[model samples]
Target: MSSIQSPKKGTHSVGVARQYSGTAGRIENCQVGVFAAYASRWGQALIDRQLYLPKSWAGDPARRDSAQVPDEVAFATKPAMACEMIARLLDEGTPCAFVLADAVYGSDHSFRRMLEARGQAYVLAVRSNHTLRFLEDWSLVQTDPGTMIADLPAETWTPLSAGEGAKGPRLYHWARLPLKYQAGQGFSLWFLARRSLRDPGAIAYYFAYAPSDATLEDLAAAAGLRWAIEECFLRAKDDLGLDHCEARSWHGWHRHMSLVMAAAAFLARIGADQRRAAYGKQNETSPKRPAA
Candidate 1:
């Protein structure tokens, strides 16, 4: 966890105009979400992270040297760090079928291109106002891309459960619209949206690239995988001390985060095994039907 100093500096601690906060606000809002990665369902127990070294800390060679921060310790943007982590995970043989993230990473065109260059498909969320080319000539399109999707026949919107939530299944209405972008082989681009059945105006938008064979169900499933990451964050922080790090230096941050991730992975493995065993037992006790 880290702090931001400037009030006009950080928008929730991510700079507004690509700048860092000053000391005052950082000291006030002190603790922040320690940037860390939890395993995707099949990901390994590797700890991949990059620490954000504030200019106040990074600029001073004396503090850097004291904390054993190496000479190569330089400031890096969050998106750059996320990309670096993803690249390293890929190099380490992590199985990545698709990429998913909120607007922070999704809004970066360069980062999206980087993933495409690696031949990976993605379903990234963006704010409602985020613009895209619905047609080859977007200017010529009569209706807004969002309106185009919204105006689709009611039958086109599928009601589905994204996953098992605390109350049972998390259900929503989803629709998609084909965009004019001709992507790489075996892939196609589309605009995906999800709206709550209870509130029509409440909608979330996503830009997706997936195999030509991918269905709305498939895209929805990929989009829902982020919830698992959220669960892991809660588990790591609440049960495993993920946010309790006292590290101030570059190396110290890495060491602290790595250890926390390791412990979190351990807890995750145990929980997964328990669920599997219970599932197997339930199957064994269920009644079998005679052949028709």
Candidate 2:
């Protein structure tokens, strides 16, 4: 999910309010949209989205009518919007390996339960102070991330790269602890943590649910995939003017986003094709050594 900063001066524009925008790195008057991006080794692109309607906007009949918001539309939290979009894609038979999201969506219990109910694996970020229930010694143990990390053996932390960034591989010390909780008969739960190599105090936490055989590497890689959505937001806004919508109506905002998503999807397809072609060319032109 991301927020689009509006240049409009008033609150008349649909979904525009003083909210925290990760794009601006601060609270600003903007429209927030929960987006779903399809990501894989092949490529990534924005596939679906929902314009968030604040309670104020939803309750204000004057504003709703003025903005032409449909009567059926009501205020839904960002996490709810995210679930709706994700569920829609899954219901449409989209292939998914694992879901990845930031703390906002991850912190929501209903959101987590929805994913678990579908038997989908996910690595969702949580706050450092987020608590979890772990079964230890036949007793339920309640602990937060900080306490759990402090109790882990130093040797348990493994250095790994989440994914490639602008500088290079994003490396960190990662560790995981099995929560001993099962979502279903064969499911497993875990608490995963990543500590900055340079600043140990800087850490991130995640709750992972997957098959029991899922490895530390699998959870770490899935956690890193969250960046793909961020990249989608950047490309959409910078190249496709996703935030340039001047629409003051609900339908208008959605229409603009739909257009931007389509353009982004087209570009992703072109890039994927180019990459495959380049790889084929490289393979064909390579000098073949005689079989020894």
lDDT of each: 0.65, 0.85
Q: Give lDDT tens digits, candidate 2, residues 27-114.
A: 8787788788888877899888888888889999999999999999998888888888888888999999898888998889999999
Model 1 misplaced regions, further than 4 Å? 1-47, 54-68, 134-153, 283-285, 289-292
Q: Model 1, 32-150: lDDT tens per residue?
A: 33243444544323345555655665677776676677788676655666777777777888777787777667666776777877888888877676665444444554444466666
Which runs in model 2 stand beyond 4 Å of their true positions?
A: 1-8, 134-141, 280-292
When summed lDDT is taken over every stretch of 10 residues in candidate 1, the lowest stretch is 1-10
* Number of the predicted model whose TM-score against the real structure is largest: 2
The estimated TM-scores of all candidates read: 0.78, 0.92
Candidate 1 vs. true structure, TM-score: 0.78
lDDT of 2 at 66: 94
